[model samples]
Target: MVDTTTTTASPGSRLLGLTTLVGLAGLILFAFVLTEPDVRLHPTTGEEFGQFDAVRLLYLHVPMAVLTYAAFLTCAVASAGYLLKRRPWWDVTAHASAEVGTVFCGLVLVTGSIWGRPVWNTWWEWGDVRLMTTLVLFLLFTGYLALRRTPAEPQRQARRAAIVALVAVLDIPLINRSVEWWENRTLHQQSTLAELKIEDLTLFTLMLGLVVFGLVFAWLMLHRFRVGWLEHAQAGHEVALAIAERHAEMETLDVDAAIGRTGGAR
Candidate 1:
């Protein structure tokens, strides 16, 4: 029989979908503003009152990093739920969030590497605290994915992965404080927009846009989890059908043997 239960969305899932769409729209608007080359630097002074290129990474990178942290937080919450309540949905959420978080973390590392290459003259640096800790965070989540693939019962798998997820959350604060941990001369200059200028206000708005985008990312995770559950349910249905067909075949063989014996005896 088909498992219909797994195919449905959670209560109020539509709200999540709506929130994601709104966030995506905001991200697109911010992206357009960030991409315009019209925002340029002074020809002589070489200083840009409105230069947008170097800061463009802010439009994508900061939000992604923030989202990565958010995803892990979601995983931690879901894992906690699984541990305390043992609900299968919580396990699914934990796995889903972890997978999504890992993807964003990868993006953060790549984008940061690109930004560093232009500003720092090196694509990779061991001394950069933010870069190093970010890489470590990526690997830690990658490890969580590997942990998920390991063999064990369902609850056992969830529990083990939950512990890993919690441990990994510690890395978030570490990554945030990495700049303080190591002294680096090549570090990207801090955001100039923090001075409360008009452009800075726009950057603040852009940051809000990024937050919206992050929510969309979270929505995507929940959707992906739903798809996983649907596939699992379909597989279970196929197994059930196979078992039923095999039983029917055995019954047919038994009936045939009985008829032959009766006919021969008669």
Candidate 2:
């Protein structure tokens, strides 16, 4: 039987592709920042271009947040495939996406903290629904990855991981609406999808471009899934070799006993 699971790209090729994407993301982000003034003026502090002036940070923050969601969504879809078809590829997809999503979630939290300090006057706030929910989502996904580390039979492991991925995804929508769902009494303004339009429309377009660039997460997820599949295949091949060797030894012993019995009869 042929093993079709091996990756087509050499290790060097995969590394090159990753490097290219990272470089492209940096260029796009730089271009987006150069296009406009990112910071807004505060009416009180007389602070124009406060830390918020690092408007380019939005380019990083929004994309990381979006990619964090995409990562989990990928995990959910992959988990579905595992549940339905029992394929190792799907399990690989789940594990890889979960890991990637966790990384982006962490990025979003850190960038949000940096942006918040200058604008909101604090590094952390429990009163902010969006912030709190985002943190919770990140922690949940982190736990999901940890749970996948459990030692169990392959099929059982996949099923358990799938359940965790799908369940945790429920928080994505919750986090998005956290601000409206509960008022934190914070000075932070209420968030709205319509407000996403305030930026001269061109800025909105650039933001959308940033969102598309964020799909780089999907590309990363693809490569990670491929690596996972290859690892799973390699393990399978090793197991098969061990089983075959044992079978061959047992056959040799059976033939030796048969020959001795025949010689004694003769």
Best by TM-score: 2
Q: After superposition, how far is residue 171 of candidate 2 from its true place, in Å?
A: 1.2
Q: Which ten residues in a row have the lowest lDDT in candidate 1?
A: 185-194
Per-residue lDDT tens digits for candidate 1, residues 1-266, read 45567444665677887877877766666665634533667899998664336556667777888888888999999988988998878888899999999998998888888877755667898766677778888899899999988877667888999999988889898776655555462274443445654455456656776767667785678687887677556756787899999999887787877889999999
What lDDT does candidate 2 reach at residue 73? 88
Q: What is the C-alpha RMSD of each candidate to the true structure, in Å?
A: 5.5, 4.2
Query: Where is model 1 more than 4 Å wrong at Cα?
Result: 4-29, 32-52, 181-198, 231-266
Question: Any idea what lDDT model 1 has?
Answer: 0.76
lDDT of 1 at 258: 87
Query: Tens digits of per-residue lDDT for model 2 on 1-266?
Result: 53765564767657767765765665565546545655568788877664436555666677678778888888899898989999887899889989989988998999889878877788898787788788898889888887877777777888998998888999999876665677654444565445774455435544654545455675676677778777777778889989999999887787877889999999
